[model samples]
Target: MVWKPDWVASKDILRRMGWSVVETTMMNSNPPEIEVPLGNFVKMNILFWNCRGALNVDFKRRIFEMVINHHPSIMVITETRVGGDRAARIIEDLPFDGSIVTETIGYAGSLWLLWKTDDVDVMLLSSFEQEIHATVKVHNSDPIWLISTIYARPRLSERRILWDSLKAVAQLHNLPWLMLGDFNEVLSSEDKFGGNQVSLNRTLQFKECSDVCNMLDLGFTGSKYTWTNRRPIFDLILERIDRYFANPSWRILFPEAAMTHLPRTCSNHCPILVELLGSTPPGPNKPFCFHTMWLLHPGFPNIVQEAWTEDGDLQGAILEFVSKAKHWNYNVFGNLFAKKKRVLARINGAQKSLASRPSEFLLTLEKQLIEEYFFNFTPGRGILGTEVKIECSYVWRP
Candidate 1:
């Protein structure tokens, strides 16, 4: 006997699965400024999926479950395979505050971009048949980046147009940019496990386009293949077609950013997650080491001189200098290492919240923390970690 679950039973099943339905709250047009406390990181989660069909009951259930469990700030669904009033009905049932649906061409292709305005501000920049471009600004954060959610055509010749169009978009802006969804093309032979080997010419063409656009694939964890034909073993094919790519600037802005492949349930394409600062693993604590950048500060010499004059012997004076220098570093230049640690701790906290339902306020808080880290630690200095050893002490490279 085939059994079906009702609304309450469905909720019970979700609760048993360790997910709870989050209550929706109305947000004010002008909310109060969010205070970003040390060690409190907000979460920024973007989910992408190509759900083959949108009107199916299974699709609706899976999408709802994902939203309640993952709490993504933004979501993009491709290959919806339905449009017009039919698409509107499914979209109305979605949990997001806002949505943009690109009408499909007679059951062929459609794209849906949905977001919650309380935590994020998404401004539509432009839209094409195969792609939708937008500017996403996480609330309480200053960094404004570009997002291109795509679903390229299956035909090789048609895909060429996609590559050119994407390249054109890249040229039009200098903003930190990210692209996600199914490109329907593999980068290399390693990305394909079965079926006819990917053509070398196609790979090179894609590579050339990426090089011109200065976009690099954001590497992923979990299953290597993201799409499957699901045919018999003798005729099965698997490929890593869906992915996330970002420019160097975006990568630097979210240094701890990561991508995860979710299990394929309601679709042939595995859902993908882009996390700005994923969970951080704890590590051994390091002893306090003096930074050479302190020397660059105008007040460093005065602090050392003042501390040295009040001391008795050479040993006493050296100890006094260390203490005074530390005090000065904290009060004046700000203890960057301590700040970094706090930011990382907050990022870990936000990542942990991903398993449960997080409020929109928490999402804004996460973005605020990320912006603080980016501006504080690496402003003007290319990227963060560069150190060398000298007499049992580590110092930043000039």
Candidate 2:
């Protein structure tokens, strides 16, 4: 096998620090070193994950890191395996304003629906054998959506009860609804790989269940196979049993919303991040800036030359140049500067806040923000007089 000393020592430390065999698999490889654009989004972040279990100390730490990175407004975790007794121990530790957890079934499964109360108003609607149903009023606005985080019963015989109960619940509620979880069944043959052929009847049953509930597949980004048996080579079995489905009505509410499968490390199932674009609230206005494309437009230099000659004093000429630039920029090309200034302003504000009153919470948030800003920095190439590290580098989309 591999005998890298650095890797061995790292694994040894994690094992000593209470990490399980599976959780350390994260250190074995980094996420594919390629950039994929998941269009920018904010507000109403929902992360659905089947953590297998959150009992291990190292896994719990990883969960905290995921929360801070995604900044999800609502998070639903399934197969948590946290019993009623242990629920009290973990609920308060989660970085959310409120949470609802269904009673665990001996050792098989559990469900937790956590939300940032500041971002949404969540009310419990029903709690069945394997699901926790709730209504979330995002931003406390109209047209609330029903959300259910379910842990499907493992056996074929018990799945009907789970399906029927959910269908009955859906029939009772007319609101737009979204359901996502590990149903323990695949949608079709294409959803499974290297697993003794998934039976046709099984796929039909799942499709019928979803059809009865009027649920349709929402598209996603990232690895298609979401759940794996974690076995090596020939013994491994993979499936797309974990997914998100929503009715047409829900689509109408958040048309621009998208789901992306984030990098998976500590869990067998990848975490799905939902960007509810329709729910994103407004932010402060962007400042003005010059666009390089303006140079290509006809008569651009003439306008600048006229403005510069009209001024009597050197200071007046400089002021004239800026004012004329703003007018032309706004009327023609639009402002292009957005990244660096925003990053610097946030870094400054976070520092001042920490200085005024130091706290662990502020410190952690600031650290993550700083890391993200530097990670996004694009080194400028053209234009000799530009700042050493400019953020307004133009990228050709085509």
Candidate 3:
């Protein structure tokens, strides 16, 4: 497909908004790779989404925004619907620089990769004698081999083919390997949701596959199943087919890695978000802070107090006080700079109103402002609120 000017503009806008857009490249060519300086730590996040069909333009745009917002380093997509010439064009449109491997027919394909940075290399290995597989190498770290989506038919023979394909990749890579995506085979009775009986033969086959590959199953603890067949027939419904298995080496590389289910949109299977760490210092966890006490100074108290007496606006008086407390530079605080400026602007406006207010009222307003600011800056008990104070150099996509 021809690259439209509008599409290029849109892609640029998306990148500015923090989406990694793929550059144009020849079909079937490896994504470009650049040497990443050796670092103490490197963190990479990979997002896996099936995309259902992605044929709808609106849905495709939403997917683009979602990836941009999350800002993963590498994205593995399954079930990409673009076919033949359209497939090449779709890959061209992706915000990241990467490659695509689609099924003979558009929507049935197992896997595709969209890589953002030049620090990583990708090699598409032989298509599974019956499945899909690829090898990815990250500069300055051990290589990671990936196997794509695997679908199993109801017949045991077909499931055997899927298992055999997995073993083949494990044997070929010989290094750290991560086999993820839809496995289509439930490993145990616990893997399914209620009312469905898992087949003993299927469970045995899955265990055998794991044993032969020397894999560790990262099972779902919260959600019992990954797939749901609405049919009433017991034989027709099976679940928990989507999973990630890795060898000890890969496990050490990502000790905290686990699957998180994304909200179900157009697809029956939920997308998985995976985080990989390579000796990288964890990024800052706490939101930026602007100290209110820093704004209160002996010399500035009189000016702010005078403004409070003239302007009755309490928030404005506090902002006026903070503006004069210039010792606290917003630029030093990184993410908190914008918020500080906004608060300062609002306070300046309030100072005019406070200039007419009584001294007592102004004092109370200042105290209240300090209290509110402190409360807002306090760390809370949650993922976003947790404080991360570690100091280390690391490279991350975000």
Candidate 4:
């Protein structure tokens, strides 16, 4: 929910009055466009890390708290060295209602999905190349084709197999899809800070994978890379191997979503934070006034009292005052509240326009607003201290 200055004042007042306003911001302005109402727009956090085989109690608790603080609608983790059973035990202890784990022994297996059961509807259709890919339906929305994780092999031939598997899944679902995780292969030279010496085979394999999936590579945000090697000369050397890909649909909800490189934990690679725009909520009707400060005028009380004496109702009195008030500003507040009604009508019309469009388009517009307007809308930046970053597409190529 967008926090306005008035809302902050209201919150402060409520706190002073000893009222606990647990929910300060509403999730969405209007209901989901689907036939049924999904409680609200879901908030999700996709985390990618190579957790170097350590899952202590303290570590588990810290991770749990981190997830809770973010309050993601869905969560996905990668490079979990632990087997599925052990991962399940850790996840089971958390507050989330459901989790799906897929693990392979030693070399390159990963955990795919861990989501809140109440918000998502899961239908296990078929496995893709023995990977745990699923067709998931979100509340009151169309199904989202999802694959938990992808572990690209070091060898070109093996990577080709993985690519084919992904293609098979895409053909099977034939819907909007997002396949994400520790891909382990950098697509271009820009992906790695200083890895020009590394063989081009892996990069070529990554390009092939992208081509087969018909995917657009959304690059990382904060840091140049996620993975790191130990050699001092190349000590801080990092590579943007971990990534995410979306078909047309997933991009709708999050056109601006990008990977943020987080501080490293027990893993060699820093965790990646994929951020998306939250949905807007329908707002209350704008307040009406005959003049900006009409209520503060000394003559208003007597006029209101006389109107009430005649009409015996608050609304009727207000109507009478509007009709009788001399030199009233129609532009600010019309005699018939027609302007207020028109504003409300405009809001309704915008909502209808949003609802009729495809979910992807609506989501893209929302992302543009957040990145361009909302996130950058800082005080002291623009009018009312809000600024919007207008440029739409930004890319760093190698």
Score each candidate by Cα lDDT.
Answer: 0.70, 0.66, 0.51, 0.51
lDDT of 4: 0.51
**Residue 145 error for model 2, in Å?**
1.6
2 versus 4: better TM-score goes to: 2
Q: On residues 1-398, what C-alpha lDDT tens digit does candidate 3 reach at each position?
A: 11123344534543453323122221123323322222223466677666666575434554554564355667766666555676667777776777646554424544566677575676655453234455566666653444454444446787788787666445432345676766667777756654547779878988888888888875532334455443333333436677777876566556666555543334556566665652234366532323333333235345445546464555565444445433333333334434533543343333223323324454345345534433443333111111222112221111
TM-score of 4: 0.54
Q: Model 3: residues >4 Å from true position, as ranges? A: 1-41, 105-107, 117-119, 140-156, 194-196, 220-222, 229-238, 278-398
- Which residue pairs clash within candidate 2? none
Ordered list by TM-score, greatest first: 1, 2, 3, 4
Distance (Å) between predicted and true CA of 398, model 2? 48
Tens-place lDDT digits, model 1, residues 92-160: 887788787787877799999999999899877667778888878788776667888999989999889
Task: Put down candidate 4 lDDT per residue, 222-288, tens digits, no spaces.
Answer: 4455665633332335567777777555665566566565544335565666665432342574223
Clashes of each: 2, 0, 24, 7
- The TM-scores, one per candidate, come to 0.60, 0.60, 0.55, 0.54
Give lDDT: candidate 2, residue 34. Answer: 20
lDDT of 3: 0.51
